[model samples]
Target: YCEKFCVFVVSMDRSFLPETPVPSSLSRRIGGGHWDKPYNRGSLMLRAEISTVGDSQEVSSIHSGQSRLTTVGDRLMDSKCKCGAKEQLILCKSRLEHLVGDDRKRRRCAVNRGKLAAAGQAALRILSDDLLAAVTEAEAEMKACAARIIQEELVAGQLRESEIGIVERGCALGALRDKVASLRAIEKASQEKLRRHVDRREAERGSVLEQLHSRLAVCNELRATLTAIKSRLSLMRHRVRSRQDSLEVARSDMEVYRKVLDEVPAIMVDLANGERETLQRREELERRAMALSEEMKEIDTQIASVTNSRAQEVGGRKRCLEREGKELDQLAQRLDAMQEYVGDCQQRRMSGSSRL
Candidate 1:
């Protein structure tokens, strides 16, 4: 039967024939070429459902604006169907339309059911989070009150009834009740016993007076003992005072020790600070010494460079002095030759004049 139902559902027209009028619910997502839109979740679900519940073959017949009762009627109805084949087919078509229509209602019902469940859960959560503790407490308090009331009722019920019995309990209660004759007998016996007890008490009282007199003598002996104890107590008090004074002196000494202990940390701190400062100064001195050594190296390099430059200048000056000294000797020999040539020229001129 379920297979038939599935086949029937799967055989319905689905392909949304070009001629099929658009419903308002589906128009937003499924549109003509001019109005395209993405399918929403609902539209997609509807499409999937339609595709599953419909066939391309049946779409033509369903959309053909006419349906024959003979087409699907014989296949859909049970063997017990008494209706005519044509009538059955019409009924089938009507049922199909009704089922199709129910799809819309089903969709709405699903949405409503989901909404109701979500709302119910939200309300339940709120109640659990905000009110459950208080409600449970109230219920517990009510239960305790009920239990207390029941317990009180049980305890109250345990008390025997105060109703006096005449013949209800017959002989048992009758015998147990105080009777006038028995009460009179009991009274007479009680008076006799009380008289005997009174005479004995009076005798005991006389003996108690004699004991009291003996106690008075003992009390006089205790009085003397108390005086001696008082003297001892005074000595003890003096010793306590002395001990207290010693304790005060010890406390003063402890205070001095405490002061010394308190100063120890400050002294240690000062020593530590001095050590740290000394270390810092030592590091600074080392750094300065290193810097001075580097400067001394630079000074030594500069001095070496200056000495080399001066040596080059001295060598150049020595070469220049040797060249100047050779030039001076050549000039002196030339002067002597020129002076001898002039003397020869003068002697030649004088001998010529004497010959003329």
Candidate 2:
């Protein structure tokens, strides 16, 4: 009757026990749990609502432990007794193999699960013996003593688990504190690096901008120089055209002079009217033709000088164009490199922020 009443009371307690939130995968992975470590033992008791349908919440004691008080009570109401710790361990190993499908993971779970199964079996044994005592009254005194001894052991186990839990958590907390400190240091370093990069980028941009301005100025000067060269070339072309027209006029004059010379001989023979006046007119025409020929020679020399100057100006402009193209290409390459660098910095900033 006492055992049954105790079982009833434990069920009632479990019914009202609060549930704890599960941890996330990332935290669990980083937690670095050891199978023998206390925190990994799970909660003091697995209180399922299904097992204690009518039970409700009440206060629990710190010293007695849920394991000592409730192990038998909880298990008596269970559908079937799970096998002993060793068998459960085998079962856990099989589960690890079947579910994990990896040697390392299975090994990790096996280590943890093996300890868990042992604790569970120890718990189950207490419950099984309790039920056995309830059904059979033989050796009641011995069983009672055994029950008290088991309860004490269970309570001590629970206390050890609790203490280990606190210690492990303290260790974990310390680790986390150290990590936070380290992260802060890294963050400071990165921020400083980023600031330096920003300063460097600013200086580079300013220099590049100044260079661009200078290039623009040079380009403007070059344009003005080219315009001046064009004007000079146009003037030269006009002079050459005018000289060509003068040369044509001189040739026509020479042809007229030759015809006049031919007629002079003819006139002398015929003894025509006013022969002295005709000879005077012919000499004046010869002098005019000679003057035209000298003018033609001067025009040809001026044309040659103008053409040479034009060729020199064109060559100079070609050289300038080639130099300007090379400068522009260098600037373009620098611009591309700067753009790529800026992009990489932005990407790093994004990745760092996401990690935080």
Q: Count the backbone clashes (under 3 Å) in each candidate.
A: 0, 0
Put down candidate 1 lDDT per residue, 1-356, tens digits, no spaces. 33444555444444432233334543321111111232233353356456645333343365575544432433444345554544535554565666556667767865674454455445545544544555565566557656755765564444223112212343443443334346546655755655575566556556655655555555565556556646777767666576677757755755665565565557557656755665675566557556655755665586567558656755665575566557546655654554465454445433422321
Per-candidate TM equals 0.27, 0.24
Model 2 ranges off by over 4 Å: 1-150, 234-356
Q: Rate the local accuracy (lDDT) of all candidates.
A: 0.50, 0.49
lDDT of 2 by residue, 1-356 (tens): 23444454444342455544433421222112222232221231323323433332211121235543454333333325543433433343344334324434545654565554455445445555654554364345447546755765675676577558656755765676576567567656755765675577567556655755665565566557557646776767766576667746655755655565465556445443334444565566556546645754665576567557656755665585566557556655655655565455445434432332
Candidate achieving the largest TM-score: 1
Clashing pairs in 2: none
lDDT value, residue 163 of candidate 2: 58
User: Model 2 lDDT vs. the true structure?
Assistant: 0.49
What TM-score would candidate 1 get against the native? 0.27
The parts of candidate 1 lying over 4 Å away from their true place are: 1-241, 293-297, 300-304, 345-356
* Residue 305 CA displacement from its true place in model 1, Å: 3.6
Instruction: State which candidate has the highest lDDT.
Output: 1
